[model samples]
Target: MTVASITDLDVTDHYAEALHEVIEAKAEHRAPTPTTGEEKTAAPVVDLMAALEKSVADARERRGESSGGSEATVHEMPAKPKKKTAAKKATAKKTAAKKTTRRKTA
Candidate 1:
């Protein structure tokens, strides 16, 4: 009675049942049940180089750069101020502790 959306993976009831079973098994602290033959098939292999190239291309296009990597320039981040030394921090803590000790002793 249910119609699958175009965006839905072709998996149907098996996917839902498998997901539910896995969730239950995980909740019970039990090992996952073995997948059926249909589920045993390997997922499509990814081309890392191609994917990276595509991502870079898309990013460059968004930033108004052409496909050529070298011509693309990135904006520089503003420099942050350096933190005070550990010695300064320790001295501040020691000063506070000395004041606390004097108050307690008095």
Candidate 2:
């Protein structure tokens, strides 16, 4: 007879086994996994919407506008691409190639 605390109920061997059994049973009864083709088709729309919403929220926050929700306003700087000079680009390419070679050999 082991005394179990509330937290112990979640962490003990008996509870863990029970949880695993429940998860396995649920997984077995669930529908088949969606095909990669279906995922690829739907993923872009979701990603685009998410990116747009994030951009709007970021723009609002930077201008000190409040969101109607309980979430804190997160100010984000607009992403600017680095202006690469010929010298910098050559140095970067050399370093990147060196890194790849070292990784492959290691």
Candidate 3:
């Protein structure tokens, strides 16, 4: 099969022109109009985080209980959570401890 470039394809023909016009009309008809109101607010970041955490915990619990043999157990197991780099965890712990100290002082 030959790959034709834009220059190689003839767009001057009546069929091509008619097809282009039809496509333009269809696109204009289907185009979404801009809305003139406040956009809907998304759920809070903390709510999304909580949902993701709950899903991970549920998956872990499900994998722990299965009595089926190796293949079934392997299929049922969720993908492992991405391991946090030790440096990242240490930085997070330090920030959290600082916050706790601030709360105590306050």
Index of the highest-TM-score prediction: 1
Q: Which runs in model 1 stand beyond 4 Å of their true positions?
A: 1-39, 69-106
Q: Residue by residue across 22-87, what tens digits does model 1's lDDT show?
A: 999999999889886554767999999999988988988999977765764779999999998766
- Arrange candidates by lDDT, highest first: which order? 1, 2, 3
Task: Give the clashing residue pairs of candidate 2, or none.
Answer: none
Of the two candidates 1 and 2, the one with more favorable lDDT, higher being better, is 1
Q: After superposition, how far is residue 16 of candidate 3 from its true place, in Å?
A: 30
Error of 2 at 41 (Å): 15
lDDT of 1: 0.78
Worst 10 residues of 1 by lDDT: 92-101
- lDDT by residue (4-60, candidate 2, tens digit) is 565566554655666676777788996443323323444444688879888988988
RMSD of each: 12.5, 20.0, 23.0
Give per-model TM-scores. Answer: 0.30, 0.22, 0.19
Better of 1 and 2 by TM-score: 1
Model 2 segments beyond 4 Å from truth?
1-46, 69-106
lDDT of 3 by residue, 1-106 (tens): 3566766877556566656767777888864433355579997667888798678667766889543322433446788899887665543444434344344563
lDDT of each: 0.78, 0.66, 0.62
Error of 1 at 56 (Å): 0.5
